[model samples]
Target: MSGDASHRPLDLRSDTVTRPDETMRAAMAAAEVGDDILDGDPTVRALEEKAAEILGTEATLWVPSGTMGNLIALTVHLRPGDRFLAPALAHVVEFELGGWASFAGGVPHALPWSAGPGRVSPASVRASVPPSQPYDALRDRLLCLENTHNAAGGTVTGPGEHRAVTATAKEAGLLVHLDGARIWNAAVSLDVQPAELTWGVDSVLACLSKGLCAPMGSVLGGSAEFVRAARRLRKMVGGAVRQGGVMAAAGLVALSRIELLRNDHSNARVLASGLRDLGWEAASPETNIVLARVTDAERRVSELHRMGILATTISGAVRFVTHADLSEKDIQEVIWRISSMSP
Candidate 1:
């Protein structure tokens, strides 16, 4: 980032910063809500049903955020002291403040990213399980996978690998949970149904706020029995709501526009390519995140901030994320400004 270094506002931090559009705001205002915890919110139920159908699950529960949804799945799948495996730098292990351990009472195991960036091999999943022991052993009970993995520059896990790894976990008597916070991006990038990436998982969570432009909410889907248990866990974790339909309304609108993420993916590639041409080591992104390796992360980030371009660091790389909020022209302008920055 060298040259003029002039201020030109653009935010490439995370897709979660996307704001609801007018249609979503109107839907939220008009949404028919009820006491979700006491009785039930009709709009919330509608969002849950739509999410379950999209994810190919028996049922769904709307939660306040993807983190809570993942935690609920973890608590439902594991007993205290049980172990769960996830890919290295998975949000479940690294980003969620250790709730899997502190709240779900499960031990965490990180599998290497041998399959690819943000992907774990089926062999690794099998190898992670402990063999029978003479004395008490740490039970490996769950395998968690992330789609459009965050720290890996939003790298995607394809449907075939998804099925293979989930099958391996099942064979090893381990339940599968997918932290699909950005599954919408994976589905669009792979040209596959979201369910294709989630097949065979005991539980899967998808975020409404990420790339969907919803204000907030995530849907957790699974077998009816599993969701029945998750509902109890949700309340236990203080995730239950009263008038959640306001948020669910925006989620409904967001789902209707999921195809829009294709533009974000396109913009991300353009940003990475542009940055690379400007002497930055920007990785070619698989989805909407570009991880550019730079000399001084903190200093370069501060420089980017001075130019009014926001970004965050992940795995020692500067990460720039594209979302519905940004257009191709905006991305080009961002690159132009970076190119204009002083050396």
Candidate 2:
């Protein structure tokens, strides 16, 4: 996606592929580092504090990755043998390598979802809970939601959806954990403060590495007590970075570039439109991800890669993601190339 070489094709694989810009590199070089687990790195502390403020939470803890952040939150929220509810395609259920069952000792209960990618409803939440009989276990103790849902093609979870589903979950005595790895995209698409999107959730995970272009870092935010427990779980799971200031420095730079996400959203829309023009069924993107229907998705992904465009195949569709590295011109070029591709 970079202007590295004229022959290089546009890389719409994933936003995670974005390389840190010069500003981020400079910040990392000049970072004020410390023994993070021992003495507390000032940069890491600053990043956590800023994340807490942004999410309107009492405290936050920095983790090496989004998966770790999410698992830590789940571990803190649920006890062993407990079950949690989430949409069928939620990353925690489908993508997390069964960590909820393995490490958190939690069982996943699937909820009905759809391609609108906004399928978690108040009714669905109520349905997840069983009748409160004395003999009933009421195993469902948590509810997980994803914003700008990845497998559903980066569709957004609007504030209205947040209120309805979260309120219902709380009423059913279920704590909510938001998998907000791409909440930045949902915020940009909805034109709302990030806090507004996360309000009412018991805990939230936000990533600096995706779309924001930070090399590595994700933060989980919640009440002070929740974060305190999450910090212990963080170390228990081997996520305690000793000198994490280098990554935190880039996270600071990433926060400063939040406004630019709008550009990626715009590019994603263009890619979707192009797919439609090419006779493929492409979902209208609400953020930086485009999921286009492909007759042979797996084969098409390989072909696209050979053609110099990298994309991912998921659930019988090809997913194209836009990021800081790809330009508007790059999107157009990719479209033209796809149009000329053989049937």
Candidate 3:
């Protein structure tokens, strides 16, 4: 369960590397299949329904990836030439390759927030709305947010913050969309229901591929009408899989195991604390991901690889993610390997 031999495969690279286990494979094999594009796969439907009920949304739709889910939601919520506001570090703004503009013809306006590590606040949202620009005048239709903001080292947006931000958007007659790809991580860290973070948002997209241990897939949830529109967009974007019960089966297993995400958070904290003890500058992880700064980022990564560990370097920091497959022993091994390297 390590990484490729060229790299020593402790694989702290990303949570996406997690593989489905025997239970997931068995579920896929036993899943009841149907033509999803036409009649709807029974397994897919069940997963969608379960997600909707869990998130307290009216309905949900399964898409191939969180990118597709977010894109589809944007397409449904906005018209061509429309604009949306989000934190400068938002995944949709920084990581998604301007898909909002290319696919949905929507414009993204960056809202300034506390730099380094912080969530967008109500005051920031209110101030970002141009004084001369009325909600309708600017053609801005949505306010997008990410929980466990990835680029910020997995910081969780609390319920109060979420309510404040969304409420401000609503006052300005704008809809709120949550890019909650790591929301389950936030829920586990905050000891709140996932619905608490998503309660007032117009639409939400949560990924099964990240911390949930699903092979691949994401679910978009909102009003029934919005989900219906997203389904059409899904097909238009070539994201409609004919018989996706195979993936949906794994998603079902992910839902059942989501409650265990706290373990990943605990492991991340332990790893971060250990790295700090080694004289590395590591942030206290609020969820499954940790970012540690080393003197020579590339050399440290190479050294870690030589010592049988895998990780990613971003903005001069090495990123590590913990998942169901990673245990406390693995975390200890990672700490030992990195500590063995001299500054």
The TM-score leader among the candidates is: 1
Model 3, position 33: C-alpha lDDT score: 86
Better of 1 and 3 by lDDT: 1
Is candidate 1 or 2 superior in TM-score? Answer: 1
All models, RMSD in angstroms: 2.0, 2.2, 2.7
Candidate 2: segments with Cα more than 4 A from true spot: 1-6, 133-138
| Backbone clashes in model 2, listed as residue pairs | none
Residue-level lDDT of model 2, residues 22-115, one tens digit each, is 8899999999999999989999999999888887888889999999998888888888989899887888888888888787899888888842
The stretch of ten residues in a row with the least summed lDDT in candidate 3 is: 1-10
lDDT of 3 at 14: 83
Count clashing residue pairs per candidate: 6, 0, 1
lDDT of each: 0.91, 0.87, 0.85
Ranking by TM-score: 1, 2, 3
| Clash count in backbone of candidate 1 | 6
Model 1 CA deviation exceeding 4 Å by range: 1-8
Per residue, candidate 1 scores C-alpha lDDT tens digits across 105-167 of 999999999899999999898788855644577888999999989998899999989999999
What would you estimate as the lDDT of candidate 2? 0.87
Worst 10 residues of 2 by lDDT: 1-10
RMSD of 3: 2.7
